[model samples]
Target: MSNEMIKCTNVSFKYIKDSEGDKKEKYAVKDVNLEVKNGEFLVILGHNGSGKSTMAKHMNALVIPTEGTVVVDGLDTKEPKNVWDIRSKAGMVFQNPDNQLVATIVEEDVAFGPENLGVEPSQIRVRVDESLEKVGMSKYKRHAPHLLSGGQKQRVAIAGILAIQPECIIFDEPTAMLDPIGRKEVLKTIKELNKKHGITIILITHYMDEAAQADRIIVMDGGSVKMEGTPKEIFPRVEHMKKIGLDVPQVTELAYELKKAGIDINEKILNVDEMVNELCQLK
Candidate 1:
């Protein structure tokens, strides 16, 4: 098997505009090339309209590039026959859990994906159980999805995708609609999915703290990638990030300010724990 789970070569996408007898095309994603290794965790950061989400859609074959190619798990997305296989391998979780939830009952919703995939009935039962357990939602299997909290609902949604047994999962701002606690819950689950389960993750989020957890970060601007590096490498450029209408993690911003004040603190600190340790070293 190839080490790469996804590859986009010189990909570009344009949205068609039709109004008042005018037909024009506006590019949402420019010529971009990227590769995601198996079991890699990649976070994409961008301001609104930067095309991060559009680029993500290509991974799952949801949006085919107007020019260039997107290959997922060795299957070319532009091929009609490969579409189903590509989608099965690369499942997507959108921003809104409510929109993704289909069944009324939690377990039923979790089962929906496998059922559609034509998994054997007996195997579907096992998968539904395992998926819920993976997401820490097994205890609520019998509950109605409507009754669960926002975080719980989102976990159930994740369980649904997990039931599909995808090799890669693209999370398009999964925590945007969530509360602080809910965001924490979802982020933890995401990390475990990638680290423990060996699943490839492509997360598109605006939260700098969330990006800090990824193995690599890609910053998008004007429909193209502006910066790409590890969290330690990317978050240190506080001025550049802010100039692009994006912010570093709160701790990183604090570290940046301290460095400007002539303090001998590490400017690349990402989390509060790191900041505390850096401050203690000043003595």
Candidate 2:
């Protein structure tokens, strides 16, 4: 049995288009070899068009590798027979809440995926309720999805994924369109899902603070892994990260500057609370 839930071995993908009757191939993802472990909170960071979304689509057979392989739960995504099983095992939550929601009522939308899977009506009902409760959306079960705030709508979309009983959840910048409160709400819910439910969480986002909370971070540039490490390990390499046009967590960047200015402070501080504690230690 494979210990990894997702594996991409020497995978590569290119987009081909006809320009003025001439064929052209542009490589979007190249030789990407990465693994996502079971029950791990892994965050992937990349600039626009860096191939993070393309890599995510392969996890569920949305797109097959042009070269190597993507295996989910030891099942090869390249094999046609495994598509349904692979998708059900690893669910994807996209950035746009509006695009993901399918029904007017919140609970109805949550039930849509499981219903399509031929789950029994009774089981679907229970799963829907459980999922909504998990995301703290049960109070608005019958509420119109459009009437809810951006955060609430995204949580409902997440509940839809949860109702399907997925082992791993891939969040593709789920909080990008949200306001600060909405972002906080979604992040807190996702953190609970990882810690309490032990579900594997794969977060793909550009927000440095969001990436800071992960157990491990994968930084991508030109569709390849530039850095992979714990947040403490990754943020300290300020020059390398800056060269890639990625920012560290706010406090970490401040500390990095302080260290640069001969303040004799640690460069790995991630949050204001951590900085406060460290400042007291120095006194």
Candidate 3:
């Protein structure tokens, strides 16, 4: 069996021109080809208007490609018959948690997905419990979603998708609205989902720190993938990243500067601990 969970082949998307005088078509994404392995944690980094979110939306058929194909779990997203199946297998979590939650109560919100799929009520109950537990939101099952913190509400939103038993989840700036604490919580939860639950994670973010935690990183620029590699490999190309209007992790940037100044520190330093250890060795 193929290990690939999501595949985009020469995909491109163009929004229709508005009836009010705009004539030229604008492509949000352009001939982007990518593949996501099952259970892998993949991070996508790009500046605003780089089409990262637009690329993510194609994973679950939320936006069909204007050219080529998006195949999720071997189902082509462009096929009308495959739309629901593809969506069920590849769930999406957007920027705002508030926009995703539909029920007043947390568990009910989680149950909504499975219920729509015609899952039995008893099965829905099991799924709701399991999904909430996976996201560490089990204790808030009966709590009103509005009363929860941003992170907690996002967990509820994730649980709602988990209830549908998706093989992969596309997170489009899931932590963009979050505080540092909330960001940590959501990031940890998603990592656990990818590591323990064996779910593929495709995270779109502007956070360099978050990208550093991924198994692989894809850097997008001008609606196409400009670079793709492991964090250690990607972060070291500091100048190249900057040229595309993106930054590396803070420590990595510091290490890069030090390297330029004739210091023997590694340019691949991704975190404070690594930087500290490298500097200590230099001493």
Residue-level lDDT tens digits of model 2 in 165-184: 99999999999999999999
Clashing pairs in 1: none
Model 3 steric clash pairs: none
Q: Give the candidates in order of lDDT, highest first.
A: 1, 3, 2
Question: All candidates' TM-scores?
Answer: 0.98, 0.98, 0.98
Q: How many steric clashes does model 2 contain?
A: 0
| For model 1, the run of ten residues with the poorest summed lDDT | 146-155
Model 2: runs farther than 4 Å from truth?
none
Question: lDDT score of model 2?
Answer: 0.92
So what's the TM-score on candidate 1?
0.98
Candidate 1 off by > 4 Å: 19-21
lDDT of 3 by residue, 15-54 (tens): 8777678777889999999999989999999999999999
